[model samples]
Target: MGGHFQGARERPNGPRQRDGECSRGAGRNRQIHRGLCSPSQFSTPRVECTPTRETPIARRCPDAPMRVAGQPQARSTVKSTVFVVVLVFSLIATGADAQRGPDTLGKIKAAKSINVAFSGDSLPFSYVGEGNKPAGYSIDLCQRVIAGIGQAVGEANLKVNWIVGTAAERVQMVATGKADMECANTTMTQTRLKDVDFSNLIFVDGGGFLVTVDAPINRFTDLNGKKIAVIKGTTTEVRLNAAMKARLVNAQVTTINDGSEGIALLTTGAVDAFAGDKIKLIGLAAQAKDPNKFAMLMEDLSYEPYAFALPRGDAAMRLEVNRALTKVYVSGDIEGIFAQWLGKLGRPSGLLAAMYLLNAIPE
Candidate 1:
């Protein structure tokens, strides 16, 4: 009588009741009262109902749906979903950061060593020297770079592990993490920059033809219908093929493994002439059995700007390499290195001297 059914009364004939009417009885009457109160009709009752401890009543209408314990409500479910999404994204970001790994200097400090890839057969630039160790003009420049790296990492006695490979293989080693950097007569081209970074210009050379002194070849036009030998996977090879195509020369190109091989092919008459960097060809011919027997053409086929190759996107390593190069250039040490490995060939040309002067960056 004191609850939401204060204005209702029991029907004398049947248990059915109209709106705002409820039966006030026990047992069967209470069941009929519960069935008659629809949730929508009693969702917002004007009269308040206070149930005592002896007669506990549900806060909602009798016909309202019941909630099982521990089930989440609609709003709570939305919040939980948002939280899960945020956590997943956080984990993904963490994984991406982990994959970035460490920088070049950190790796060097941890390993206490640096790996350098070089060409074991390319003379003057890089080659297997006395005692089967790596030596040459490029190797000397690389040693200065290594010394700078040692200073950066605070390791006065950093070990140098020289890995010998061809030009293509040396680039691959630097790109794939097998070596930290590659020191060779590697030319810096727009195409090679896609996979690796390069230091300042180290040397300047041009692609040219090397032929027997008595051979009939004198210029680019003389290469027509002749078999030319070049080292496989070199810029000279690509430039030679392009020059032949541009000149409309029908020449057969034979690829060899290294400078020595090209020299062998040309010496044996397997090819009419060998194509390579003019400076390297001169060094190779000088090492031949009869240096005077070979003649290098005066024609320049391609301009080659040499540099050291490092891992792509590694600005720190590149800076150190260039710093070392600048130091050598500015301190007059490069002249000594050039004279030691290439003095016999003659002094650095005017173009090469200008290259050194231009790349000597200030501290």
Candidate 2:
């Protein structure tokens, strides 16, 4: 097997959130188990990226440090190669940027319309609602962010042009200033931090699998060599790839555009399982024709702290966004948003409550 996971900071358990905040639930502050819908399943996969066995293996000679022609890389070199491959991917991801404009808040003020990128199918967070209009927890938070921006920028009625895009498109859109903010359930990770900035932690989540009850997989070990489906351009994909690689799972992975396709694949038996944020999987499963047809693997593939992706280097705009979020947290408005969207799934966790108290800046 490959080397163990290193340098990954698991979102702590217990009162994992900051003090003065109420916990959304008792445990890791996972998604409310909402039968949440994510537009991710609805979109056409914008990009497909994965190594046949992962190029990192090639980048780092995991075999012998010095190998003869045609000789396999020695297992002794595996540990070092694991770190090297991870580092290389990190460098490459951060180095390539869209060269986003410097002043995101200024651009918004000048344009008189702050364009916020939102997912088209991200349920309970951001998604298309009645009449095809955008709605969800994150979308509402972005509206609140706009209110904070309007207050900061001296525009009481700043126009917010909702820009709907897929997960792959939203990061570049924000980094390039095509969108002022990505108001969706996007996890902030070291690789992505290279391209765009992130707001204060809004939601903490982890990976879960949705498999047909007929062939249920309760944990990671069962997924070995299984055919799995996940949407492209998501942290879920990255985590899944890394975890599978580290565990040396010879699983066949398929990428799709949206959650719907993933569900269809699971239903149609195109793949063995559909994997995503546990909350998102719950959302997909909830909406499935047979809610009882699917089972969620309790095992977590990785920790996901969801935040808004913003333009790089625009701390002011980020602060404005955070200030809006802080207001929401301070005023205890988040519970209502959660109720409005995710309440159907379950009650908010104590950890989620703590997230607001921790992130809310008194000053």
In terms of lDDT, which candidate is strongest?
1
Clashes per model (N, Cα, C within 3 A): 0, 28
What TM-score does candidate 1 reach?
0.76
lDDT tens readout by residue for model 2, 267-338: 989999988988888877887899898988878887888999988888788888888888888888888988
Candidate 2 residue-wise lDDT at 135: 87
By TM-score, who's the top model here? 1
lDDT by residue for model 1 over 1-363, one digit each (tens)? 132212232224445333333344433222223433344576644333223221224544565564322334544656666877787799889988766543787789899999999988778899999999998999988989899999998997889899999889989998899999999899999989988888999999999999999999999999899999988889999999999999999999999898898999899899999999998899899899999999999999999999999888777778888888999999999989998988987888999999999988888
User: On a 0 to 1 TM-score scale, where does candidate 2 land against the true structure?
Assistant: 0.70
Q: TM-scores of all models?
A: 0.76, 0.70
lDDT of 1: 0.83
